[model samples]
Target chain A: MSNATQPTAKPDERVKEISAFRNALIRPELGGIVGTVAVFTFFLLFAFDSGMFNSQGIMNWSVVSAQFMIIAVGACLLMIAGEFDLSVGSMIGFAGMMIAIFSVTYGWPVWAAIIVTFVLCTAIGALNGWIVIRTGLPSFIVTLAFLFILRGFTIFLPQVIERKTIIGGILDVAEGDWLAPVFGGTIFKGLFVWLGEAGLIATFERGTKQGQPVVDGIPMLIIWAIALIIFGHVLLTKTKFGNWIFAAGGDAEAARNSGVPVNRVKILMFMFTAFCATVFAVCQVMEFGSAGADRGLLKEFEAIIAVVIGGALLTGGYGSVLGAALGALIFGVVQQGLFFAGVESSLFRVFLGVILLGAVILNTYIRRIITGER
Target chain B: MTGNSKFHHGDPKGAVQPIIEMKNIEKHFGRVIALAGVSFDVKPGECHCLLGDNGAGKSTFIKTMSGVHQPTAGEIFFEGKPMHFDDPRDAISAGIATVHQHLAMIPLMSVSRNFFMGNEPTRKVAGISFFDKKRADEVTMEEMRKMGINLRGPDQAVGTLSGGERQTVAIARAVHFGAKILILDEPTSALGVRQTSNVLATIDRVRKQGIGVVFISHNVRHALAVGDRFTVLNRGQTLGTAARGEISPEELQDLMAGGQELAQLEGSLGGTV
Candidate 1:
């Protein structure tokens, strides 16, 4: 009874001070950015031996990096929602095959084939979501089964339509002019190309018979990748669906109790991942003019590796779409850098494995420190 | 205590029904009967205390009331009208909010974010969505001020807050969202004496706002201090109900221990050895 009415220190003040301190060090995507930079620097150092330090080599690597970045961004969002789609690689091959079978074999218009293939691909994605929701089974198992199913379908699909192992219509989109400017176009011409060649004068152009600029123009894939990255960043940071994705992965039980439709969110995540795979398939088909069963083989592992390297937690709940795109860029740079550096192409797998493992370990330790678990 | 005199003068016609009423509520988890024929009432603007030992159906009762589980047999009336709740959302929509002992909050999320997690403010243009962080932060800070919670900012992660502060935040959030019937499950069980006082003060504040409060706690002294009426439950059954004036601290303790039943239990324990 001595001082029952005395004022005390406010609780919110203390909480705010501590939270401000925590925010200064725990950036959501810092780990991924750091890992990407580290890998890029490593490759850049080795790349000098094979003239990869030159502007032309840099432009070529950048072009190759763009495709992986686009697909990885979408994969990152799906992973953040607490599910995976191993069937993405197969979906890519299937979409490419569908476009080829329709446009080339059936003699349909390219635009119509593209639209139809996309619709069919989206349907396949919805089907995958339906199966997972109905069975209440692990998505890893379900999507793995789907991967095999799609692979078999892709191989047998051509035989059914054309009475042969090979299909002809795929070559049109892969090497066609109508889509070249959109999907397979180059971007580094005009001012940038002239500026890159200005300093080198005619000697640099003379060394190469083709008289191409010292640096090639930016690739269309790079433009697409940048656009996708911006869109994904906006979607993840500013949307209600983005918040739901974080909540679903953070704690499914708590989210469900809070009235979030966890099942629907997970299903939508899977469908989005599949849609990304289909988009990538269309791009690949345009670039290669062939829709073979092996078009996207093992690409799923690359996408997952990119996400993991980008600092996405294996257990979900924390990561960034931007980080995943950066990770894919790192992968592409390393792949092209090694080729230019005269490293045996067969040894690329070992090098990638080491880099991926290192990134995972670093990501785990950083996460632990951020959470104050160690 | 003069219950007959108070009954005659205080209640008048005794026509005012409870804001919430539960009768003959039975709940079972497989073979175990968690609650059997339990009944209780909460009057408006009064702090009703539910006292019990551990495993005396407190959790079961709270769950049933919050719509986590449908009671096996029961009649529940809200404002003299029968109602059915299929889920926690249903209870929430009905102005019945529950603050559990553990508190349901995402630790990694900030205070304001957690406060407005499900009911977030959004801005939409051309069917695309955008979260209004500025509005959310502003509204959350205003709510905190109204609840007398002095915080440095709304950006602090809720995990960093002390246990009593977290409970206060949860209670404040529920109250801000228009909860009329607030159920606090063991709110002070995990707190120290000072924190316990803070929670009791919060309960009093809630009652003063004309909200019916069901405060569940095992601490007899604390319950007696804040409670206007006390109901005792033993083995999932109602032992008795007593007005705060009708029971002394020691008498309430005895009733909570099952009085005669406890004496028989002591005798058996002493004789067996």
Candidate 2:
């Protein structure tokens, strides 16, 4: 219509060019980016003198952040596909427990145990998605049901077979195990050793391992977090399947009408979420050399909160994996930053609730902007 | 209207074979019959309007034609060949694309993304095939432009467009994807006067490209504006089909409102008056 009045071709005037500020506000990652900056600024101002920025302190929070990052990446994608997996925490505990049972109680090789655990966990994830699709029930309710079921088994099976809810000795069995190192081992050991030798890093002064860097190497957990984030980000933004994910979450009927395989996208997202949780679990059990029934307690909600904070809509169909990763980073920093700043550790939960509410409000506002609705 | 007039009044109906022909189609849902014995045909470069009121089997007839529902009994000939469509996808592959009232678009998605929702353009680098965003964006803008719509940008959200513009996008998408027969289900039912005009103009542009159009609507004036022939349906039955010059708007409206039933009511009330 705008083309009619002007003899010379001009840009369509109907769509008034939005201000740069407003355009930036429309991005799904805005809230996550802002929150990350604010949280980091606050912690840096308050905890800079407390060794929080030191190599050891950085590693401490990075490890914590990586834990959240792993599961948050999964939750972010699944949420974008318009579903939830409330069973992630339970999945972690259950997967770890299964690995322990398979390796320790059954005396299976550690590699076989880890592989079976991954397969079994992914299968259960697929089952979660299948049940949701077949029954037409809300994914929240379905995954909630699994939360209890998996956690119940996590506690029950160990007690029945080993007479305890906690299993240990995995570190010994995992020694020299091929697959275990992928989840449990560290990388860049030579670099850290070089840094320690060159006096660029803090070295243990008086221990049996004198001159070893306090920050030894980058752990596999952090590596997994980075790898998964990159994978999820690429999968969500750069592929045809990524577009289908957005369409499926935005409107399933519309997507289906357009010939998109909505159900398959949703199911794959669910399985990916479960896979992320298993990675977190395996890394945890390897690092700690034990699996407790409560190993991953409340981790699902934590992952969901991280996703929401990263600016993913709880209602689904709009989000960023990068945003979710940053949200996880915020969680890691603040949780450890509290200790460095001498704040109570329990304040982290309170912070989570507050940040989650703020992020949701921001997301709702962004959604309104995108949809041009109230 | 004047620019598009030459093609609008071309009248290529008789010499051309119908792109789609439905003969004696019947659709029954359990005990109720949604459509019965409805015969219709659309020649290339023709807009055959199916006029009906609510519950006049307009929806049922279109659904049956679009492969949403298998007809209880009927023969559908596409391109002079008898065929059965198992689903909407089958119909789509057969070059019959249906643009439903809601348009089946994600509002928050960019126009380019929505245009290529299911059928995305892609390029491969190092064995990794990714969506070719630049190509998609350019094609979307170019297509919209050809349909007389000047989109702000390819990245502009579909929700930001006017209702008529969205309809144009849907129509353009269907046409771009090799749709030989475009079935528009009430494409302008919820638009303002100007928006409706724009959509009608879009329909005219599409028909001139030699695509058989099945324009389903209850609006008599809309049907009369662009349709080469008008077919009226009532109570799951075809009242009749009339070419453009043979049927007046008043007669078309009366037929759509069930002319015999209206005449019977008038006669019954005459004695009392």
Maximum-DockQ candidate = 2
Per-residue lDDT over A116-167 for candidate 1, one digit per residue giving the tens place of the 0 to 100 score: 8878887888788788878978778988998999988988988787766556
Per-residue error at A176 for model 1, in Å?
8.1
Q: Is the docking of candidate 1 incorrect, acceptable, medium or high quality?
A: acceptable
Candidate 2 residue B89 Cα shift, in angstroms, is 1.3
Fraction of true contacts kept, per model?
A: 0.19, 0.45
In angstroms, the error of model 1 at B173 is 2.2
Model 1, residue A182: C-alpha shift (Å): 4.5
Give the per-residue lDDT digits (tens) of candidate 2, residues A110-163: 999998999999999999999999999999999999999999999999999999
Candidate 2 residue runs with Cα over 4 Å from true position: A1-14, B1-13, B260-273
TM-score of 1: 0.84
Q: Per-candidate TM vs. native?
A: 0.84, 0.95
